[model samples]
Target chain A: DAGVTQSPTHLIKTRGQQVTLRCSPKSGHDTVSWYQQALGQGPQFIFQYYEEEERQRGNFPDRFSGHQFPNYSSELNVNALLLGDSALYLCASSWGAGTNTEAFFGQGTRLTVV
Target chain B: GENVGLHLPTLSVQEGDNSIINCAYSNSASDYFIWYKQESGKGPQFIIDIRSNMDKRQGQRVTVLLNKTVKHLSLQIAATQPGDSAVYFCAENPNNQAGTALIFGKGTTLSVSS
Candidate 1:
């Protein structure tokens, strides 16, 4: 079975521009979460989606938003990107929205804000 | 405020030597903890996890120890190899509820020299 997959492995965006990253969760998984990782740092949570609804969000601003499709795929949108927004966007998938469940991560989409 | 931090930023060990990485978390309500390893140009990969109820959990060659009393967590790698060179992060679910986002540490870089 294929694992979690993310689109546009690498991307470049200018300041004040918008960018959209896509993610296809692992087979048989339902929950999707997004994270941002700067160079040489661990990932910081962005938000999580379950059952086509956003269930949890991190400290990110309104500029960061996400959507989950019925097929468990997800999309992360960042509006008005800034230089600090340049980082690796990681998508994680879990079997269920349950405590102690394992979340598998995708290779991530590298976004460069110019 | 919730935060997870590592005791060390970098660790170098000779091949076949065991390695230990430590992390401290600020959220007392966190119940689930996970360890992830990420290589250059890649996303975090789950190594092992332990819940607050359990003090220790062993996997193939890795062990995760969780001390809820002190809000501390640790990962032990047996007979480390060159392939094990990567950045290690400890993540915790701040809230015990399902669908909550995970708080990750800055990460500890492990370099296993052959």
Candidate 2:
């Protein structure tokens, strides 16, 4: 009954550093997606992974990347992090690719770029 | 986490009152819509969702109404509680292989005072 799980609940990094955040999707879920939420705004989609391949991506730059393992776990990597990249990073998992599948989210990793 | 702004339009309602949070989606082709409630330091939680073919979907104490013609979506909470206070977001997706990304709108902060 475990929901999605993410690692490093909070992180502190400096400008130009790199960070990798991990996520384990819920049991029986096959798709994982990542999002970034800035203060006072809704989450902006980062990308989605399915079948161990990235299937969809948002408007973020190439410096932001992700990977999905065979077990449906995911990792979000941000290179040369900027202060603007500092935000709450969220991982969500859903069961199917079809419509009406509900997505469950984990407690996000808060990245603070100093 | 809830988005905060000195000027963020907030709906302050008594604990026992019903609450309605509204969102206007931009994509007319969006086939799936979801409502998520995000509390401080946590990721967005799925509250409810509706597909384009349906006008309404109801959960335990929540309901989602979608008006495709108007490109509007709403979440209705019955007898809102302090635990219900959070930033509510509306996310839309076309539900297709080519457009599986969920685009989110800026959320509205809902405050319920007991």
The prediction achieving the highest DockQ against the true structure is 1
- Cα RMSDs, all models: 1.1, 3.4
Error of 1 at A50 (Å): 0.3
Over the stretch B16-100, how does candidate 1's per-residue lDDT look in tens digits? 9999999999989888889999999888899998888899999988999888888889999999999999999999887647575
lDDT of 1 by residue, A3-105 (tens): 9999999999999999999999999999999999988778889999999999888899999999999999999999999999999999999977765589999
A16-103 in candidate 2: lDDT tens per residue?
Answer: 9999999999999999989998887778888888888887888899999999888889999999999999899999898764544888
The DockQ values of the predictions, listed in order, are: 0.74, 0.59
How high is the lDDT of residue B105 in model 1? 89
Q: TM-score (0 to 1) for chain A, all models?
A: 0.98, 0.97
RMSD of 2: 3.4
Per-residue lDDT tens digits of candidate 2, residues B7-112?
Answer: 2347789998999888877667778888888888888898888989999999999999988897788888999999999888888886566436677777788999
Chain B TM-scores per candidate, in order, are 0.95, 0.88
Superposed on the true chain A, the predicted chain A of model 2 yields a TM-score of 0.97
